[model samples]
Target: MNKTVFITGASSGIGRAAAQLFLQQGWNVAATMRTPDKEKVLTGANLKLLQLDVTDSNSIEAAIREAIVHFGQIDVLINNAGYGSVGIFEAFTPEQIHRQFDTNVFGLMNVTAQMLPHFRKNKRGTIINVASIGGKVTFPLYSLYHSSKWAVEGFSESLHYELRNLGIKVKIVEPGVIKTDFYSRSQDMINDENLEEYQHYLKTVFNNTQSSGTNGESPEVVAKAIYKAATDGSKKLRYPVGSPANWLLPLRKLLPESWFFAIVRSNVEKGL
Candidate 1:
């Protein structure tokens, strides 16, 4: 029997790409999104489109239950439903901060919690968390986004130790700058005109960040990495994908704190 992978945020980008690739590779796909009705791309006998709001526990439960019912078992769970909240940290309202953590951190934990019992029973499974290279490093104007991803990185690392004993694996896919809706449709930019001091810095950094995203690799690159993590059958934890991430992650580790911070600041402050 072929394995089934349940993916969140499957309407587009990395999630959609992963779903398509898995189906093409002869695996069952439970492609989930907030508005499944609007999705027209993923369709096949082996694909099941379901509605899932990662921030909502009821929705998470319903989606997981439905997926298991349809596919009999889920061999992999991809926690990919998240958006970026960018801009001045002080400009962000409490609600924005809460929502950022809600979707990116708490929501991911909730989904993983729901899958644990099932995976434990089966004694074999893979949990792939779609994090960002930002999780390991930082960029300007993305404090909130970076913090949330950092939380994911820490959480996944700690969880891996416990899950390994249960015959379940935890994998983190960190993509540097994949050309995806994350830079637009899914990005939340916080701005305050009253904060005149940050305007110049924000503009310079935001422009640099946007340029990187525009020139980034396709989401398919990250999807391939996700596929490898799921099927590699190794205890490997972190799979960094895309161009700069392949270099930056190692560079960050090799360089001193001052050196790395200076490099990041210089890159984002090019126009300043």
Candidate 2:
């Protein structure tokens, strides 16, 4: 029997790529998104396009149940539904902050909670979280986005220890700057007319960020890394994808904290 992988945010980018990759490898894919009706690319045998909004518990439950009913079981759960909330921290409203955490942090936990009983009963499963290199290292104008991803990184790390005893695995896939719709459709920008002081700074940093994605790897690269984490069968935890992440994660660890921050500040703030 082939395994099944349930993925969120499968309408585009890494999630869509992963769904296609898994289906190619003979796995059933529950490719879920808020607007499944709009997705047209991924289709074929063993593919189930589902409607799932991670921020809504009822939607999450319905999608999971439907996938299990259709495919019998889901061997892997990929938490990939999230967006970036970028700009000056001061520009963000309380509601925006809540929405960011709702979709990125609590929303991830919501899906995981819904799937845990199924995974526990099976005694074998994998949870691959699609985090960002920003989780480990931060840049300018993405404080809220970084907060959510950083939460994901820590949560996955701590959960791995407990899940191991249940014969389940938890993994993190950190992509540096994949060429995806992240800056366009998959991101939200803070807008506060009162915060004119930060507009120029935000524009500079946002431009630098866009340049990184323009030169970054394709979404398929991170999709492949996610696939490896699911099938590697090892206790490995973090799988960093893309160029700068491959170098930056290690560099951040090797260099002093202040020095690393300085380098990041220079690159992002000064566009160096």
The lDDT per prediction is: 0.95, 0.92
Off by over 4 Å in 2: none
Name the top TM-score candidate. 1
Candidate 1: tens digits of C-alpha lDDT, residues 1-272: 98999999999999999999999999999999999999989988999999999998999999999999999999999999999999999999999999999999999999999999999999999999999999999988888999999999999999999989999999999998989999998999889989999999988889988988899999999999999999998899999999899999999999999999999888989979
Model 1 ranges off by over 4 Å? none
lDDT over C-alpha atoms for residue 33 of model 2:
95
Model 1: lDDT equals 0.95
Model 1 vs. true fold: TM? 0.99
C-alpha RMSD by candidate, in order: 0.6, 1.2
The best candidate by lDDT is 1
Worst 10 residues of 2 by lDDT: 263-272
lDDT of 1 at 122: 99
- What does the lDDT read for residue 57 in candidate 2? 94
